[model samples]
Target: MNKKDHSLLTRSFKNISVLFFIVVLLLLFVVILINVLFGIYTWDRLYMDLINALVGVMIPLVLFNFLYDRFTQQHKDRELSEKITETMLLDEQVIDRFSNDSKKAFIQKSTESILGKTVGNMVYDTLIQSYLSKSYQYRHHFKYYISYLGDKVTKTFAVDDETIFIFNPDDYYFVREDLSFERDITNFIQSNDVRIGFSYKESTLDGLYQRAEFMFRENLWVNEEHNSMLQELSNHEMEQFVKSFLQFTIEIDGEVVPYQVIHNEGYEGFHLLLDIPETLHSSVLSKVHIRFQMPQLRTQKKFIVMISEPTEDVEIMFMHLENEMEVEAIPFLNEAESITRLPNDTIKIDIHDWILPRAGVVFVWNDRQ
Candidate 1:
């Protein structure tokens, strides 16, 4: 072989080796960067780092993806808010009965998966509810469906032994928020004893994995137990029923959310402290809804609900003994100090002047139910 041909071959080999080495270095850098971004979560200064990174050049790719998604989601959410109703529809096949062990297992498994295996039981199970909540949100970057359709539109089903799917319209509001609203979810979880699990519908988009899981959560559902008594009026057998406390059945959102509200004393008239589901727009502290048979009182005709702390908006509603019975609540003054008379027809307490916590009179009118 000629000297020139040998020299050309040697140079080609060196160039090829250098190019391979460069490619390997670039690939290794990419892998390390991804691991650093995803795997390295610290207890300290992590949030500030994210906030600073959200700007132009330094923004993390995962953060950018989530931010872009949530930004575009605002439009969809606006449409959703108008279409969706505020209340939840309870499904007939909803699974309410769970063995104690089953309940514990659900809670344990749920917390562990979202909060990571190393998180302490006390942290996820008990205190720092908000922390666990953020962890739950961080578990994925996707969305799901909720049951409630809209206001003035409610439909119940009667299924045989099938799973009853109780869902809130607000569930979609929180769940689809992506990573932008992780702070809010975190705060909510910390305050609320929220243990959440999922139900799969077995469908997906990107791959074979299930996608559209119908979301549900736990809530305190009201039930009516008749406490009938004797009423003697001019040889009349008219029934006079004195109302008892509103019986609250702890429905854990079709066994998806395992939070059991432990009754602990709060302020003057606040007995509940743990939580309502994350789906609802209002906080647990603000909501004041009382349902009774509308006591057939012989003496008192009117009742006044007062607000001690003075809430900006409060709902005062009433439901009749008859299932078909519906009521329309009269709007009260806008000021928080102003009081409103309780009407028999009111069904929802979406807005209120204020529920005077000091007086804390939760009962309705004495004469007219």
Candidate 2:
């Protein structure tokens, strides 16, 4: 039984014993008064007889109550042990029979045979506390199972991510971001500063080659000056200019890997095919470095880094290379580990620990003076 039940039982026994003793005292007092009124014995002799009677009644009552309580406790303990044993047997699908009571008697007995009983009980209690907790419900079993499998299949942890923003001498900003992470069947998507985009669903035939597509919207100039600078360029020249501003490279285990980029039919963006080695599918680490430039016409800008998978450490730095600017960094769904401002006009934000998906940092900046 639990502690609350045991305590209630003990309290009830104590109350009953007290009530019985009180009734016995009242009966003995009445008998003594009747004898005195009838003049059968002197007051002192009556008092002595009353004392003897009281002693005889009280001793047997106390002894019988003690024995009864001991037997009752023993019975309850046996019942509790039997219940636990039956539960364990049912959990293991053991045949319910007297002869098989000792067969597969849970982890407690199995562990006790190897370790001592004390250590075995400790292990058993720990497991019971964890798996058989009161908070656990049978209805949530599927939910818990799905969560376990999701963590296993989609497990990707980032080792390090560093993004640096440098203010250029011209009316453009330079950004270089480097990221290292463990990959599984992960899809990496990259896009420019476009309002709308689309991606092709990954497809594989006969488990050999995979095909996918990435789309980007046509460039939307923020100001007339920005539009005039690239208005005279042909389609090919515009594509080259855009490509020059946005460059992407990837490496696996410190070796450069080749990838194909093909222009999609009737689309503004291109299709990419990555020839990832089968041997380094999920076991090896990969790094991606991207360099891009943003025009100054977009005065108020927000640079957001969204975490799509588990990550360990992330750092973002903003360096004032040319002009002064006002910058503020904010973390979503979590607090940053540290934000430091260096002596060389650099603001760095660091986050350490396992950051879940959809939790990320946002850097907002605007021109000053």
Instruction: Give the TM-score comparing model 2 with the true structure, all chains together.
Output: 0.40
Off by over 4 Å in 2: 1-171, 185-245, 262-272, 282-284, 287-297
Q: Of the candidates shown, which would achieve the greatest lDDT relative to the real structure?
A: 2
Model 1 per-residue lDDT tens digits across residues 1-369? 899999999999999999999999999778667766887654355656657667654557768889999988998898775443221113323223556455455566656767787785555565445333433222111111111112232212123433222223222111110100001233444455332211111111112111112011222121111111111111111111111111222232222222232221221111222344556433322222221211221122222333322233443333332222222223333434333334543233443333322232233332223
Worst 10 residues of 2 by lDDT: 140-149
Candidate 1: regions farther than 4 A off: 1-188, 192-315, 319-369
Top-TM-score structure, candidate number: 2
lDDT of 1 at 53: 63
| lDDT (Cα, tens digit) per residue for candidate 2, span 275-298 | 545445454234433223333324
